[model samples]
Target: MTKRKNNNKLELIVAFSWVLEKVCDSEFSLLLPLSFFIIEFVIAIFLFFQFSKEEEEGVEVAAEEVSEEYTFQHTLAGKLWTENSFNSTAFKSTILNAWKLKNPVEIQDLSKNLFLFKFSMKRDLEYILRSGPWSFYRALLVLERVTGEEQPSDLTMHFDTFWVRIYELPLMLLSEVIAKKLGNIFGSYEEMDLKDAHRIGTFLRIKVTIDLRNPLKRGTVVKFKEKNRRDHFKYERLPTFCFIYGRIRHQLKDCEAFEDLNEEGFEDIEEQELSYGQWLRASPLPKVIEDQKKRDSSSGTCSKNIFNVSSGQSRCKTKEK
Candidate 1:
């Protein structure tokens, strides 16, 4: 009986301590204390969840803000920008000096590798594109000129090029012919000395920048009449510029064939300047042939009565070799 009373006393003490922890009011039902404890626990759990949710939202907002800043500032993108080796000041100064851009309002960094230059002048933007395809520290910098659109649209210029080899013709003469014949379709041309000429052929790099608004971009082939022969050729993007050797990459201007020609001197070739109207008059090949005949007659005994199969197979007219 005494042991049972002691256990009862211990239970009562524990109950009293739990009630004291729950509520200040002693007259209230113990059930109210239990309900109050459950309410507080639920409130704590809700607050914890809300905090976590707010933290996640904050992170997402920060990320979005960073992306917006990048887009708002950059007007150009390329390998040069990705490296972050430069800043807006460098870009502004270089471009302004090189391209003669006047009064650029703002220049800012976009992303890690892009830049934006704000100009009030529309011509300033055009100047950028016209002066672009830049090389800085040996790395090519590609620029995209933004037309100040709120949303990005198709704004790329597409061009095609091909390697043209003119056989049995001189470089200057053929260039003149090509320039005249292809002036409408050919945006520009560069004489590519990718390889040594075979004492006759002329090599050139012809690049045709096509207007996207034109039908020629849809696989159109270029055709022209040369030497009474109708000829057709296609444009190609050739890996021609050799950054190291400063020659056409694929043509190898330093090829072994040119060594012999370099040793023996060549004629002081003169370029014949012909107007556009003259190129259309007739075939210039006849004039070139006449000139060649004159040269051969004077130097190679063409005027002499040489013994030939066409003539008479008679006395030897062969000069000492």
Candidate 2:
């Protein structure tokens, strides 16, 4: 339709020029200056429209090139939740060693403490996500798989996956359905450990992708068949969190909530009223031994990939490689 319009405009200009030439060539000599002004005005309009069309095409081409360059696939973007600066070289070397990928991957810094991990294989990408939440220098390494055209610096990474153990559930409620329900309450439920389904242990472990923006949930009261029971939560591989806010992003000293309370003349009182304690941090379980135990387990069939996360089913909307 635009092409047709352009053609019609060109034809009109041509006919107008022909008539103008005839008039200029004839006895209409007094109107010569006015004719010249009309001709110049027509030429200016045509040139303006012509240049605009070319500019539009050029802009469209440039946009396509930019989109292609920034488009990422099988990639993970990460951010270290800390105010302190870290050695980029050490971070790259340590993360490369930690991943242990069969194929080499590219790790690039997006900003201060923000990194992007581009994977050659989807399997390698999946492994990194499943085995999280990863850390560096005791600071929580928040991971999110890359999707769409989002820049790494623009990515909001307040969520990370953790194996949260819910202690004190009755034998009857110790099922996957119950586990999913409890896991959702904390964050996004990923997977439940069913290796020791038959054996009742101290706690039931479930993989949950939780938001660090919110304070960690202390515990919840469960009511089943009119029977009320209390359950406690313990997060494995938990990183630095604000005790005052129950948030994992910062410490009590760096907490905004602490600052607000302090401003209200509650500094001394709030200092002793730390809500979250060291009990929230779970004891470190040996990764190698746990993998070995999962391998030898004969009771339940589970995913061979040690990382229990499934991106499609994740409650947290973040990406990591």
Candidate 3:
């Protein structure tokens, strides 16, 4: 009876210990899920705050960009208003103000390259202003001021003169000639010395200096002789000033092949002033007879004697009269 009672007490103690362990494990499992929820919620809040901050920064940047564009437009408008005054003082003041407002960083960075670009822009703006009643001059002037260059003087007069001459020309011919000349100017060529006349002839189909500033008036013709006994005459209708004034010569005042054309008629009566009209009227002589005729005309009495002796030799006549 004593051994049975001892075994039953040991079994009761083991069963109570197992129930306590199961209760502790269940409580730990519930707490672990709650801690994980708290950690996830904190991380979500942190990410949301970060995203909001980035969006605010983006909005601020966009606003700044818009403000800059508005400021530039405003400056351009102000310059236009100032240009309407037509007073030098007002123009200078406007330019100075614009310069003061320009960004120092840009000025510092582009100073060197800006020099030529600013000059070209200023020149172009001045031309546009002088051209018509358009109000875009003010905007162009403001741009020039910011870039740092002075507008050309008498720009309006030059533009007017250029257009007047260009309009006088036949539109089709003018476009064609200008296009051809520009191509010639920019085209590649073999290296040549400016002083060497022979080298120039080797490359250029037609060598002439054209002045772009002043075009030729209507009814003008330039003529040249080719080796094949043909005359080449180029008629000008409202040609550019360069066509009229530009002279091609081996030396100063020394025109090639036709240097005599530049001389006065005091030396030879037959050698008259070579005008466009005279060149048009002149006719070419046969190459074989040209030299002989010139020699006979120059020798006068001597040529007559030579002709008489040649005639006598062919007839075998003894003249005793």
Model 1 Cα lDDT, one tens digit per residue, 1-321: 446444655565566558666565655555676756665565455444443333556633344345443332334432231222556466556545544433454555654434556656555455444433343432234455553443322423233222333332334444545543453454455333222232324333233343322322112233433444323333222222321222221112333443443455223211132111111111122243345445544533323121111121111122437
Considering every candidate listed, which one attains the maximal TM-score? Answer: 2
Higher-lDDT candidate of 1 and 2 = 2
Judging by TM-score, tell me the better candidate of 1 and 3: 1
Single out the weakest 10-residue window by summed lDDT for candidate 2: 308-317
Best by lDDT: 2
Between candidates 2 and 3, name the one with more favorable TM-score.
2
Task: Give the per-residue lDDT of model 2 (tens digit) for 1-321.
Answer: 468557856786787778778887899967878976886687667755664554556633454456565446678898998887899999888877666665888888899999888888787788677777777766788888777568655798888888887888888777899999999998789998875444546678888877787889988999989988999998876777777778776676666677666665544654346888678877644454455565554344433322222221111212333
CA-lDDT, candidates in order:
0.38, 0.73, 0.28
For residues 183-267, could you state the per-residue lDDT of candidate 3 as single tens digits?
A: 2332322122222222222211222223323322222222224322222333211111111133211111222434444355223
Runs of candidate 2 with Cα error greater than 4 angstroms are 1-58, 61-71, 256-273, 285-321
* 2 versus 3: better lDDT goes to: 2
Ranking of models by lDDT: 2, 1, 3
Error of 3 at 50 (Å): 33
TM-score per candidate: 0.29, 0.65, 0.16
Lowest-sum lDDT 10-residue window in model 1: 274-283
